[model samples]
Target: MKMLINVPETVVSDALRGLAAAHPDLTVDVEHQVIVRRDAPVAGKVGLVSGGGSGHEPLHGGFVGPGMLDAACPGAVFTSPVPDQMARAAAAVDSGKGVLFIVKNYTGDVLNFNMAAEMAEDEGIQVASVLVNDDVAVTDSLYTAGRRGTGATLFVEKIAGAAADEGAPLERVEALARRVNESSRSFGVALSACTTPSKGSPTFDLPPGELELGIGIHGEPGRERRAMMTSREIADFAVNAVLEDLEPTGPVLVLVNGMGATPQLELYGFNAEVQRVLGERGVTAARTLVGNYVTSLDMAGCSVTLCQADDELMRLWDAPVQTPGLRWGR
Candidate 1:
């Protein structure tokens, strides 16, 4: 498979350079592998930080700005960033108020961020953390001991970041982040396998006319593979999978996310079916966001994430955010 990267070894650095050039408001340290907001260490504000493997674009890195993450540390493609990187990010963003680390549930990420949290605390910077494990698709995977963190990572970051930006203390921000995680669930389906730059080929063998349900972002094995299904069929399966576990008492915030390679047109069509499913199940979509947010590298698929939203969650979700990937009401 052909990729735009100059070489596998420098793919992460090269992308970081480009991201730095594209977003001058962000301080991208390519060598140290940290991306931080230009106006970091906001006085009296709890800092927000999140990160993961490089393949998922516009996630941890693209989200560093005024109303998202204060800092992000990117690892290699589909690899976890080291504890030093996270520690550096925490140091960069931490105001006197404290910093909050938004961690996904993957084992490597969990371990590294936990170590980083301890390191930050030793440095006299009070810290709290929220572990996002909203992927209801699987309780255990190769990368995680519990449910894999996927699309809901975005929700946690946005909502918690909004709270932090409002000068909320570390404790409140951490609680909000954890509440968002607990109120959300996600399920993904893969139409084609992703290709990592290092491998330069499909990560898995997904035969044509077939699809894998419950796929992880790094192309981990999913629940099962079966013959390809239509957009409506896939939406039905994915939405039901999420709703079965979510069981929201009221309205929901829906994210119909493309898994990197899927086009906007297809994602919109799929979102319609997802809405149909929600309506049939007597659920109201308080707000709907579509397009690629949480993603796998060049994977032709999508995921549906549902967050059971109350008035407070909805207010935070609607708050102004000035990030490269997700910007609205700014």
Candidate 2:
């Protein structure tokens, strides 16, 4: 595997150190593998925490800041973070209001976060959780019992985090998070597979002239593989899958996310096609995000996430957010 790294085992640790160095506003607990805002335990606000495997950058870690997550625990590459990391992060960020855990629908993530929630309760910290299972790709995958969580995770964290930042109660935040999941749906198409650091090879194989549809973020087997197709065709396939599941009306939030290796140039093309498809379906994209927010290591592909939006959800989405990965507004 041709990667710029001193050692495979220390890649995650080294990257965490680099992230802390680059963003001083965030604090990295190297010992416990948790990243949180420097000014954590925000007085009366409910804390928000989420985590998963480490390959997807700017996800659980880069999202720690004022209007998003309070803390993020990162695990080894493509592996779930342990419960201790989650418990410590919850303890560090809880400031009386309580803490909410936003977990994806992976088996390991669900189990680990549940254990952490119990541990936090034992320590006198009230906790709530929301599980995101928005990927309409497949009902069950290698790491999950149901649909695997994908791009909608960003929507959940941002919108729900905004509510939490505004001092919404833990139960309310959890409710909003769940609502976002219910309203969102995602579909992915992969032109290539990602190479995990430890394995030092592509997680799966795809012929040069084909792509995998309904792919998971962790490089799990998608629903099917098909011959290479045009951008319009790919966009139609992805957007249609989400539309079939959601059938959203009115304003919606659209995210055209690059898997990893897909260039911004290609992503914009995909975005245009996505907009076209949504327009044809009478769904207007009031808010749109295009680029690499969630990704595999070096996979070349993209995923489309559609969230049915309302006035309240849009207002929260437009709220000020200051985080390493996504920052805008005041």
Candidate 3:
């Protein structure tokens, strides 16, 4: 209900304007609603593109830069971007090395991005895609559209973009991305719900003292709801479930993402608890990241993602990456 905005319909478009102005290195395609790196088609480097709804800030758009994504398509708030936007990004960033599309496992995202791939192919562009379905909370693949690609999408984009930046072949990059997707698992808990700009109210209700488990980023109800508990207890439940599923043999990469509105100070404490639980379970976190990587609009919740890693994967994971959202190796 209490939000800083002039109107709902202009939320996404207006935000895009602000993003472009704030990050001069990223060029906003106002017409198509695509954000491309200021220096796209970096000679022979393969282009990387990821697109999704807008509310997930610093996602597809935040990640448009040198080492990560060449371009990102932003749809209306919580709505998938049309294929036309993606097609423009594909054309603008094609550098003869092909393009890799990192798509999340949402029905609308998959459909729109895949269609854009087709549109790009019509003009003889080589486009490959990897669908990230790493959320393990939703087990019934037959019933649901696989698992919701939550925080794992961040790892996928960074690692895959690094691979492409290294001049790895498109097929190899695609394969590596798939490996990350398969080896990763995620689960979330929500303490409060989010309100969309258009609606001007919470999407769903999570009573003052209740929390939902296995929650998705779209404000979708989780598999289970229960009484609130301490951070340690919540960390135990989330870490235990992910560790149980992966049983990672060696060092694993962990991401504790805040579902918007949870302050970073809290995220650090949350990560500490996550680390403690993993240590108790005899799991080593080779690389630990804690922040708001993927988030619901304004939901007070968090999700933890784990990717079982090998030497090669870890090396690739550590490789240089640059983007508006995630920039390193500067």
Candidate 4:
């Protein structure tokens, strides 16, 4: 148990303090544990709020900015934030228009976020929710809480945020969100495990010459653990799974995401394989983003996200976005 923290309980609070200080444009709801844009309640504009565990940086929190999330609440490391926090977030972000909650498919996340939505509705706030379930991995397995929401969350948030920021109606925003979900698929592999600061040790041990297929963020065991293979082979398996699931005939927005510890060199190497796979299927990668967008803290591996793209999807994707985690041409 070798960790660098003085107190395990203070991890989230301390991190939130630093986050708020670092970004004054966003306000921290200390009581609710949610980070919201300072000028919230933009009249007649749909509000977008999402939340999850704390370990996945730049996810719910780092994404709170222009053309993205309106609010992101933090739970404990890999744990869901409480319903009260979400309720407060919904209430704060809601303008006269409406509110949309983007939740992953995880049981805890769904339950808590839904509870908050229900609570907000009691206050006469119209709330809509879109659950992201993009992982190609089996959900009922023992490793994950359910079909873990992985790479596609980024695309969903970005596109939905763009629509919301554009003052699109709540129905349009929700429709776009579901469109993104229907067209996107994700797959991942793990070479190493993550260490929870509280636990002060790795969550699981992977033998020297093996890998986990369809791994989840909370160190849930993937569908299958097998001997390690070449990056090309691994990419083939992952990309193929997504392709099979999606059966996409057109272009895609490809996201080659490293779990945590996998290096950029490895990511590029894996991308090469993904490129080959895409070429074989007559699928052009219209927009390719490679990095660690969502991670399982310090775990080594990568996930491939295929977002089926059209002209409309591309326009929204290319829209300017500024957030702590992702900023480009804004």
Highest lDDT model number: 2
TM-score of 3: 0.97
lDDT of all predictions, in order shown? 0.93, 0.94, 0.86, 0.88
Q: lDDT by residue for model 4 over 1-330, one digit each (tens)? A: 565566989888888888889999999866569899998977778999999998888787989988889899889999999999888889889996889999988888889998999999999989999989899888654424556687889999999998888889999999999999889999989998889888877788899999989888788878789999999899889999988899887889999998888999989988999999999888899999988889888889999999999998899999988888887774
TM-score of 1: 0.99
Model 4 bad stretches (over 4 Å): 1-4, 142-146
Pairs with steric clashes in candidate 2: none
Give the clashing pairs for model 3: 62-325
Q: Candidate 4 versus the native: TM-score? A: 0.96
Instruction: Put down candidate 2 lDDT per residue, 258-322, tens digits, no spaces.
Output: 99899999999889999999888888999999999989989999999999999999999999999
Q: Could you give the candidate ranking by lDDT, starting with the highest? A: 2, 1, 4, 3
Error of 1 at 277 (Å): 0.3
Instruction: For each candidate, give its TM-score against the true structure.
Output: 0.99, 0.99, 0.97, 0.96
Q: Give the Å shift of residue 17 in candidate 3.
A: 0.7
The residue ranges of model 3 lying beyond 4 angstroms of the native Cα positions read 140-144
Give me the overall lDDT of model 2. Answer: 0.94
* Candidate 2 ranges with C-alpha deviation above 4 Å: none
Every candidate's CA RMSD: 0.7, 0.7, 1.6, 1.5
What are the clashing pairs of model 1?
none
